[model samples]
Structure formats: structure tokens, C-alpha cells
Target: MSTAAVTDKRHSTLRAASLPRWTPWVIAAGSLVLGIGISMAAGLDSQVQWGLIAAVLFVLGTFGVAARVEGRRQAKDRVATSLVWVAFLLAVVPLVSLIWVTVVRGVKVLDVYFLTHSMGVVADTEPGGGIYHAIIGSLEQVGLATLIGAPIGVLTAIYLVEYGRGRLAKAVTFFVDVMTGIPSIVAGLFILSLMLIFEMQPFGFAGSLALAILMMPVVVRSTEEMLKLVPNELREASLALGVPKWRTILKVVLPTSVGGITTGIMLAVARIAGETAPVLLLVFGNPFINNNPFEGAQASLPLYIYQQFANSAGSGAAFDRAWAASLTLIAFVMILNLVARGIARWKAPKTGR
Candidate 1:
């Protein structure tokens, strides 16, 4: 081939057609306008219908335009990208709507006074009480459950990852899997059966026992995964230094994975914090404040929300209290997640000097 012809071919290959950065925005605007026009012409009243139409139009328009301007390959890529964006928006919509509704309704009743007092003598319809008792019950129950569940779970995970070698290990693994799938209500019922046999009445400690059951499997699974992620070379190096297996695990392995373990524990705590069925079957939901978890029925936020909503009977005040409690519970869960993240970041192992 001639030198000029070779240069022309190389330049042509390098100068492939490219779309402008603003093309997606232009396509999206056109799709929205077209969708709105079609909705109006069809007399559609639902915003959801309009949004779906716009999403469909956006995907179709991007494919068609890219095919014409670029190529079939580019068109398919654009279509896939558009579909992913649409899916993300669809997933985000319900969460945004839920948070918005909660904030609007909850602020009507959430106040310092509402948080500091208890529903001692007030009627649900009248709604001049607070969730202090419920808050105390939740903290104590979750704290106690964590104390009981986390250690056992960590030790089980350590055994499974480090020393598991026989039928005993397989049996433990099978049972952990079984426990993972056990429903919260079933756990509560199991505890309830024990209580019945022992002639024990509903109390906060009973609820903690049920929550601990729910928490243990989660902790075991999370901690096991974290331990497995630690490099085997570290264990070998420790053994070469004449370190005991237990000392190696306690001094090196545990510190390296402590951040992940803490995160998992927080997640487990959040999972149990909002449980209503177990609390209902065990704690029994008291309206008045009771600090002792060992003896008397105690209130929890989830149970309080349920009771308030159930007793509302179309009463606005009662409904307001329910919404406020729901908001508080959500905030508590969110705070736990944030704290977990913070701890994970803070305790994460340093890789280099």
C-alpha cells in the first residue's frame, strides 16, 4: 500500500464518531416532554403512569438516536445504561417517599416532653403521654441480648474457621444454618414455651432471650466471613514465631477483624431493636415505666408503635403518636448504622508504616 493510503486509514480509525456529553440530558428532556404530551392526550391522571411512560420513552429514544448517529453496538450500550438508570430511580422512589411521609407526620407530635414521659394514665385517644418507658426497655433488652449473643457467636465463628475438622464441626455448621432461617416469631414462641413451663410471666428479660436467639446466627455468619478474609500467611507467620494458636487468634486475628465484627454486631443489634412480635409475646407491652427487666412487663418502641396504631380507632392524636414512634425507631436504626460505619473506619487495620 502507498504511504498516503496507510496514513488515511489510520486517521479514519482513530477519528471514530463520538456523542456529545450533553446528549443524554437532551434525550431525557425530550422523553419527558413527549411522555407528558402523550399522557395529556390519553387523559391519564396518575403521576406513576406519566413516570413509567417517560422512562420507556427515554430508553427507546436513546436507542434509536444512538443507532442513527453512532452504530447498533452503541445503541445497545445506551439502552443498557438507560435501563440501569431507570432501575436505580425506581428503587430510590419508594425509600424517598417513605422518609418524606414519616418526617411530615412525625414532627406533629415528636417533642422533648413526648420523649421524657410515659403513657402512665393517659388514654390512647387523648395522647398526652410519651415513650420514655419504651425507650428504656429497648436499650436494656438490646444491650443484654448483645452481651449474651456476641461472645458466643464470635467463639463459634473462631472454632469454625480455625479449628473445625470433623463431624462435630459439620453438625455445628448445619445447626447455625438452621438457626439462621428460624423465624423471629418461632424464636419468641420457643421462649414463650419455656416461660410457660417455668411458670414465668412476660418481662423484658424474656424478650431479650428471644432477641438473643435471632442475633446469634447473624453474628456467627458475619464474624465467620470476616475471620476467613484474614490472610493465612499471618497465621503461619505467628506459628513460626512459636506463638500459641489461641494467642495468635487473640492478639493478631481478632484485632485485624475487630472492625468488621463490631459492624456485624451493630447490624444484629439494629435487626433486633425493631422486633415487635417477640416483644409482644414476651415483654407484653406495659404503658407505665418499669426499670426492672427481670420481673415486670416492659414496653418497647416497636410494641408502643403497634399498640398506638391499633388503639387509634381513627383518633388523630393516637395516629400522630404512632407516626412519631415509628420515626424515632427509624432514627435509632439509622444511628446504629452510622456508628457501625464510624467504628469500622476507625478500627480498620493500618496496612503500611
Candidate 2:
């Protein structure tokens, strides 16, 4: 054969064969059917089990089919992609289920009446109570915690990133690391110890203190990361203009990373907002509406949920209330996250003006 014919033959042999776009979908459908059949034959009841079996079959079938038709390299790539998708679904399934369950169960008692009133005279088993008291307590405690924690956390982060040096800085960093891993119960216990020493009672402010302990480490770590991301060139530029060091950090570095800082603070707030152990230990939940967080035992959302469940003694009313409170807590956290993103967007440093 001539060189032209040989070249054409080599090119044809080297060209990869492409599968139809719908091939994977067809394989998945077949795998699902087979998995269902197997599950039925083995008398398996759980949908989760069938899903897992289907996922496994789909992955294996894809690899085997791809290897035979396409090539080993293509098969491996397909397998990796399949695994990633499977992992994503596995992670999402539980989250979706939790949200679904919450919505279904919570809506049974989550009405305007439930939100506006409180458990003032009503018993847990009777079903005529609300979360107004818990809402007040949660807001006060979390707000107090944020007020006490955010500034301190931000300042500490600034110090660590900007001016920290030697043993003191290292010690601070080490302590912050240690605090970050400390359990919520431990933080509550720490505050409890202080309360015992001072002969203090459980109040909203005590929960605030425990929450502050938890919030500070998160805020410090997140803010430190945000501050680090601010380019040193901005600081140098400001300093070159004869600006003071602190002023440069305030005007240049901070402004540049303000969005991230706010996001971090909001995230820290969210992290502490849902904590039940600390609130239970420090606030010592009360059923009656107590607006003054500084004076008496307070009811927070998490604590309310716990109390409802515990005090219900297997009453449907209590379980329903717990679910509603849980839903409300989830909504509150979601709102914080949304607000954080909004602030980040609004305060994001302008470019290309």
C-alpha cells in the first residue's frame, strides 16, 4: 500500500468512537429496574437500600460497558465522574429528608397563634402555647453574645495578623486553637463554674457569655483568614503615603476585606444561635415570657425545643411544638446566612470604577 493509504488507515484506527449522549441515562434506568427487582426478590423494604443497590449497579455497569466500548482510560474517567455524582447524592439525601420531615411535622403547629402567644398558663400536653418567649430570649442572648464577641474577635484577629509577634502572639494563637475545638457543653460548664463562684443564677446573659466563648474563636479564625487575604500591597501603598500604621489597617486593609469580615461574623453568629447545650445550662429555660435577659431565667429557641420534647412526656402536642421550634430555628439560621451574603455583596470592595 502507498503512504497515503497507510496514513488514512492509521488515522481511522486512532480516532475514538463516541457513545450516544443518552447512553448513561439508559444504563441508569436499566440499573434501577434491576436493583428494584433484586430488592423485591430479597424482601428488602427500605427505599434507601434499593437506591444504594441501584447506585452501585449503575457505577459498575457504566465501568464495564465503557471499558468494553470506549477504552480503559475512558472507563476510569466515567467511574470517577459516577463516584462524584454518587457522593453528592449521598450527602444531599439526608439533608433533603431532614428538611422534608421538618416541614411536614412542623407545619402542624406552626401557625400565627403559635408564633404570637407563649406557654404562659398552658401545659405542654394541652397544645395552646407559642414560641414568643423563646424568640425574645434567643434574640437577646444571641445579640448580647454578638455584641460582646464580634469586636473582641475582630480586634484579636487584627492583632494576630498585623502586629502579633513572639511568645504572646503564639500563646494567643494556641489558646484560640484550643478554644475552637472546645465542646459547647464545655463552654457552658466553664460559665457554670463562674456562676457557681459568683453565686449567680441562670439568665440570658449567662448563655450569652458561654456563646461568646464559642463565637470568639470562630470569629477570630474567620476574620484572621479574611484579613490575611487582603493584599499587603494595599498596606504598603497606604504607608508610603505617610499614613499611620493603624490608619492604614483601618482604611486600606479592613475596607478591602470588610465583606469577608462581615460574612465571618454572621457565620459565627449562626454557629452560636443553634447551640442547645449552652443555652440549657446557662439560661435554665423558663416557660413564661421574660423580656429582661439580664435578670431572670430565659427561654431560648433551642432550649424551648428541648423542654417541649422533654416535658411533653410523649404528648403529640409537645412533639409538634418541638418540630415547629426546630423549623423556626432553621429559618433563623437561614436568614442570618442570607443576610451575611447580602452584606458581603453590598460591602464588597468596588473595582474597575
Each prediction's Cα lDDT score? 0.91, 0.91
TM-score of 1: 0.90
Once model 1 is optimally superposed onto the true structure by TM-score, how far is the C-alpha of residue 316 displaced, in angstroms? Answer: 0.7
TM-score of each: 0.90, 0.91
Instruction: Please provide, for model 2 over 94-180, each residue's C-alpha lDDT reduced to its tens digit, 9 standing for 90 to 100.
Output: 999999998998989899998988889987788779999999999999999999999999999999999999999999999999999
* Model 1 pairs whose backbones collide: none
| Candidate 2 Cα lDDT to native | 0.91
Cα RMSDs, all models: 4.3, 4.3
Our model 2 lands, by Cα RMSD against the true structure, at 4.3
lDDT (tens digit, per residue) of candidate 1 on 185-254: 9999999999999999999999999999999999999999889878888999999999999999999899
